[model samples]
Target chain A: MSRLRNRTKFMNKFFKSAIVGLVIIAVLIFLHFIGWLGPVEGLAVRIFSPLQQGTRAVSGQGKSFYDSWLKKKDLLAENSQLREQLKSNQIDVSRIKALQEENELLKKELGFASESQLKHVAAKIISGVADPYSQTVVINRGQHEGLLKGMAVVTENGVLVGKLTEVGDGFSKVLLLTDNKSKVAATVQNSDRTAGLVEGQFGLSFSMTNIARNQQIKEGDTIVTSGLEGQIPKNLLIARVESVKEVESEIFKTAILKPIVSFADLSYVLVIIP
Target chain B: MWYKYILWSIVIILAAAGQVFLSSSQNAIMANFDLLLIILVLLVNLSSFERVIWFLVLSGVIMDIYSSLPFGIFMVSYLLTAIILEALFKNFFTNRSFYSLLIIGSIGVLVYNLFFLSFSGLIYYLGGSEYFTNWRYLGAIGWQLVNVVIFLALAFLFINYLSKRFKPVFLHS
Candidate 1:
């Protein structure tokens, strides 16, 4: 019985506290609605506004940073794609340039062949300096194309380049005029039509020897094949006389010659079909 | 084994073709570079004797088909070079190291040139070709040595990198 009474006493105390708490909450609500708590609310808002704004600013910056990252990723992909396109365009440009060069060479060759009324076969150089010991080039046309041994090979401008030394079925090897083994009967364009044997010296340059001391030869005089050799035709440009050497004790005068066409740049040539 | 031989034969043919292409005068240094010789030198150090011999013979035959040199000239040169390389690998360069490769490759180039030039001279004396030896020919030998050393070094580094990256590790029991 005493325990029941103590429990009731405890419940009464709890009810008293709850009633007081309810009354206080109701009074605060009334004060808030009647503007009685305005200064305290203003003070609380002023204290929390900076933190709220900081959170909002952080979220905005994160969103902007994420947007910029996405943009950068897209730009990188676009840049790589553009780089690939540029590489392909560069290859196309080089191909077009090569085709243009080949076309120009063919046109010039056609012009020369048609003007001279010479029997010829157009051939492209397949390889250059095939022989380590000799300055030789392999041509695409060979015995199959009626290119025989000792056939004269010339450039598009009718400049004598070499002769077919080794002729295979589908390919022919041309011994370039710069080769030491190369020899040609040439005549100067001067009045005397000075006869000399043009020989390659060390695969570097040409020297026209066996010239009579009385023959007048000077620098800048054009040297052409004299048609003395049955394989080579007459009046094909070989070289220009660079300098002439005369010695009274020597039996023959020699003239140093310079080839106008570079052997390295001989991409296409014409085989004079004898 | 058969497939390996076939692969090597194909490589030899390709090397021959590459030689023909590099022989062009468009680039002088590349023209002087002997890709086949470099491959042979490398192969001698790595492969078995029988396979190396087969490669050497194939290389010589294919090169002879394209070369203006007398028949059997390239074969002799390549064969002798293989023999020398084999001896050197067996004796001095037993271990497969970069320095060993460099030394062997350098000596191989020199030996090949010596044999080649000597044979060329013999053939010229016998009235086979019009080739005349000059100091400039020696320069070609030097360039070929440089090319061989560079190629061997690059190949060594690449193979080493690949081996290290993909090596299978055996765990201790």
Candidate 2:
């Protein structure tokens, strides 16, 4: 009889629980269908949310009471991280652009490095300090690399830019061909092979003098180093002949030569060291 | 009798609102703390089943009204949490020290949150909401857990303190 009562009690409990569970489920389903949660929460929040704030205020410091939800610091941290990432990305982009420019410069320099007889040291143009009186540039290589005074400073395209005048342990200075005191022995690259002494005029242009009035120099004639008798090498590019002028009273004709390379854009340079 | 129930209900509602306020004001990468759950865990553990069961129901309904979850979702989760806890905490704990209360509250918040989040997700799936919030599982859960630890400590301390110093005569001595 007790066993029967136990079974009966068990059934009764099961049925009751099942019924309660079903009722709960049905109510939840109806509420969900009606979408009443939003309004209810809104009203509750409008009425009671302040109490939560009050609770926080009373619990401790403004910080202690707000507890885990003072997430401004977290957001600030995330903002900082993202900002750092963006900064790094920007740096990488600029680095890529610089590398591309260097690659192009190196590709142009490859032939000069290989075809030249003299050993070459690549140096970056640290600065171009040209005044009205002289045009000079500082390079990153110096006497430590066996760079001596009077070594030819040329661009990647074999254009003779300057001659090294002074050297230090870590840097050297180059006197550009455009400097007033600069002098170079050059020959016009025509069939006539007219030779002349080129000298700088006002740190701007070079005047090639001592060419005979009858020399076969013309417009756009290429001028190169005569390699006559100095530490300078032959075939070093100087400039192109812009115009040849002749005066009846003068013994030799003059040609105004325009430099093939621009000084403002010079970055990478090769020092031709003997 | 039921007047105390009304007072407790008011307290629970206010606490829920304060949590909501804090969550809204704070800018975060989805790091909202479950303050309501922490408060409920304290209440459930401290109050008797007969007296607090109705309060739990009212609190759940209030939370459901306040929450973005479906109407019955928080209601159901709160009810289930109270029921489960009412049975589980019966005579199991006597120590009400600061550390003991904090540890117990942490475990309670963890369990309640798991249930709440799971039930809400189930309801969301049933509701056919197209937005699948996978982000909530990763960083949000971690931050929420941290929140649970910190908030539980505070909630347990505050409620435990009040329950100690300000006991009415009708309450257990």
Candidate 3:
């Protein structure tokens, strides 16, 4: 009789608690529906901000420790050799001059970056998604720092990295170009001046299609952002053409590109604010 | 009574933070085991039905905060998954066996991912999926399977290791 009473009491308590939990969940869903969750999300980011930074730091230290411990002597020898090569290369100034001449030739054809008025804010990328499934990173800048959604983010060398998709008060998330869902309007910097839509495909590579069949594009041509409608600036270097596929029956051809800037090595970027 | 829940909340929040950190740093994408799933499965095997339900609520909240998707999508999916797992646990499955653990983990992953993707697809479509629907989720699901295998093996080892002195107590409970 006592055991039965105890079991009945537990059941009653459980049912009451369950109802409370359900009500709580329902309230949260309603709150989310009305878009009152941004402040709450900002709070969560604020709380986890230190943890995120610490994780990044620890991982960096661990990697650096492993590298130095394994390659100390070898790195010293390579450093001396590199220093010697640098002295010799400094005397060979003509090599840089020739590269500059080739760069100017490419720019003359594209006719971009001459009259560009650049407005940018610098931010350090605190952490990045290592998974190939989604390419995103959390940066230290946010609404207080004037980061708005759809702002174009680029590297120090003016290479397009991604755009700000979500921004909070203290943090923001960037969506990378290599992400499988990402799409960018790009133009080829060649004599033909072909324009196409670049789309990420198969989690591993990108294919830019929609080029007219008669447009002439070489394998080694460079591709840059179309900068359509003044949101994302035009002529930001995107990728270089590795191969082009043309089907006579189709109106559009596709170009396989090798992304110029290495996404893996990115640690900082400048957000182009409008 | 609610103190244990508070403690578990702290633990889950820390685990979520760790999951975010791990996925973000050193490119450890291959080792991206779902820490949240591992914790919930352990609780499902060990806790009462009502407790699992509450934990699911907590799980949903954490995932919503951590994920970039709109709020409550994961919360709803997790609540449904927890109820199913609870039903299976309370009436059908034994918590003591290795095979049960394996089966539960595998099926749980499939159910959770499909449910999540369904909700995601709906929300994104409703919001207009012009460029948002090209994710390679099939490949990511394969990776999730690998993660499940690894995490379950470790969990089993942890449980078996604890059986040294409290074998009967640990196994039965």
Query: Fraction of reference contacts reproduced per prediction?
Result: 0.20, 0.11, 0.39
Docking class of 1: incorrect
Q: Which segments of model 3 are wrong by more than 4 Å? A: A1-26, A60-116, A129-132, B1-4, B25-30, B125-173
> How far in Å is the alpha carbon of B53 misplaced in model 1?
2.6
Give Cα distance to truth, residue B76, candidate 3, Å. 2.9
- State the iRMSD of every prediction, in order shown: 44.4, 26.5, 4.4
TM-score head-to-head 2 vs 3, winner: 3
Tens digits of per-residue lDDT for model 1, A48-83: 334433433454466567678979989999999999
Report per-candidate DockQ: 0.08, 0.05, 0.19
Task: Give the winner by TM-score.
Answer: 3
Q: Is the docking of candidate 3 incorrect, acceptable, medium or high quality?
A: incorrect
TM-score of chain B as predicted in candidate 1: 0.69
List clashing residue pairs in candidate 3.
none
Between candidates 1 and 3, which one is better according to DockQ?
3
Order by DockQ, highest first: 3, 1, 2
Restricted to chain B, the TM-score per model reads: 0.69, 0.58, 0.64
Give the C-alpha miss distance for residue A200 in model 3, angstroms. Answer: 2.2
lDDT by residue (A180-258, candidate 2, tens digit) is 6678888988788899988888766787989987778888989999898377888888999898889999999999998
Candidate number that wins on TM-score, 1 or 3: 3
Where model 1 places Cα greater than 4 Å from the true spot, the runs are A1-111, A247-249, B129-173
Ranking by lDDT: 3, 1, 2
